[model samples]
Target: MTAVIYKSKYGSTKRYAEWLAEALGADLLVRESVRAERLRQYDTLIYGGGIYAGGIAGISLLKNCFPAAEGQRLAVFAVGAAPETPESRKALLSKNFTPAMAEAPLFMLRGAMDFGKMTLKDRMMMNLMKKMLDKKPEEEREEWEKNLMSLWGRASDWCDPANLQPILNWAEN
Candidate 1:
């Protein structure tokens, strides 16, 4: 059986985790309170989190346990503002993860961003980012940074249930 582990801020990744756990009928784990050694109990692992400035969900989990969690089928899913298109797939997978993680199966799901849920720091940073972007000439702005600020999928079931088919397939295999 698989365990669904997630690290969510502002509930976007939590929503995805709930949907995934329910659909797969798997046990769910929230990263903050998880027992590190307990991870060895499952052969299949599903780790998920919302994106923030191009970082993975539960990064601490991976850092603390990836080296010890042997014989597990690790599949990562990121619920982000990125679309589920090929461009997004390329960016999400290629830009993130270490060599070991890059070797593991990865999926990108659409996540929401609520300005209201953002902290005062995040708001200030966003404002600074916007102001910086404005200072740049449109043609001179870096492609990657532009995409980072432009969230394609917002406030919907953009993370399609069908996308989790890979999880099912992986489990079956």
Candidate 2:
């Protein structure tokens, strides 16, 4: 059996987890609701969570539950607003995961962003980021900074079934 465990703050990671669970005929679990002991029952464990401030939300749960997974196949996926790029993906992986965890098949998936739906804390943080980016010269601003400025105040969804294909193929093998 397979288990799809996820934690999502704004629903994008949950959306991906739901689709992946259906595709693999796996059980779905919220990170907070899952016990480390419970993960022992699954042959494959897939973890998904949203990325915030360069960290994967709820990742501590994965680190704690990992020991119980033992010899099971493990995969991790991260959802974020930033466009998928090799450099960004590498940096995110390097910052968030240990070498062992990093060995698992990992996927970086694009997620939706709606400023209107964000919590006050997130709103303030984004606004602060926008201000800092605005202060930088145009030539010094990164591509993501430019994208964030362009997409500010606008809601967008980049989630797609196609994005789950690589993860699916990795799990099947």
Candidate 3:
């Protein structure tokens, strides 16, 4: 049996976890609710978390409990507002995991971002980022900067059922 565990700050990662759990007919849990010893019950473990400032939130769930999951098949998925591309995915995985952890099958899922939904700290950080980007020449602005600027103050959901297919397929195999 498979178990899905996730951490979501702004609902996007949680939404993906819910869809994946339903599709796989797997047990679902929030990261905070899971205990390390309890993870041994499942043969397959699917962990998902939201991305913030190039880090995956609540990844400690995997890092801290991996020993208990020794015999389990593990998969990790990351939800982010950034556009999905091989380069970005590779960079994210590289930045977030060690070589051993990076060897696990990693998947990237697009997530929604709403400035209003963000905490004051996140809003301030984003505003700071925007200001920094604004100082850059238009030609030097990266794709992400353009997207972030455009999405400010707006809510968008890129969560799709199809996006879970790759993870589902990997788990079944």
The candidate maximizing TM-score is 2
- Candidates ranked, most accurate by TM-score first: 2, 3, 1
Residue lDDT tens for model 3, 70-161:
66888899999888777778777877776547557889998998887789999999899888988988788778778877777789888898
Error of 3 at 99 (Å): 4.1
lDDT of 2 by residue, 1-173 (tens): 99999999999999999999999999999999987888899888899989999888888876765656468888889999988787888887887777657678778999999999999999999999989988999788888878888898999999997899999999998
Best model number under lDDT: 2
lDDT of 1 by residue, 1-173 (tens): 78899998878778778878888888999998887788888887889978776677676676557645667778888887656666656766766666666566777777766666679997787678778877888788666456645642233345566767776777678
Better of 2 and 3 by lDDT: 2
What TM-score, over all chains together, does every model reach? 0.77, 0.94, 0.92
Model 3 has an lDDT value of 0.86
Backbone clashes in model 2, listed as residue pairs? none
lDDT of each: 0.73, 0.88, 0.86
TM-score of 2: 0.94
Candidate 1's TM-score reads 0.77
Which pairs clash (backbone N, Cα, C closer than 3 Å) in model 3? Answer: none
* Candidate with the larger lDDT of 1 and 3: 3
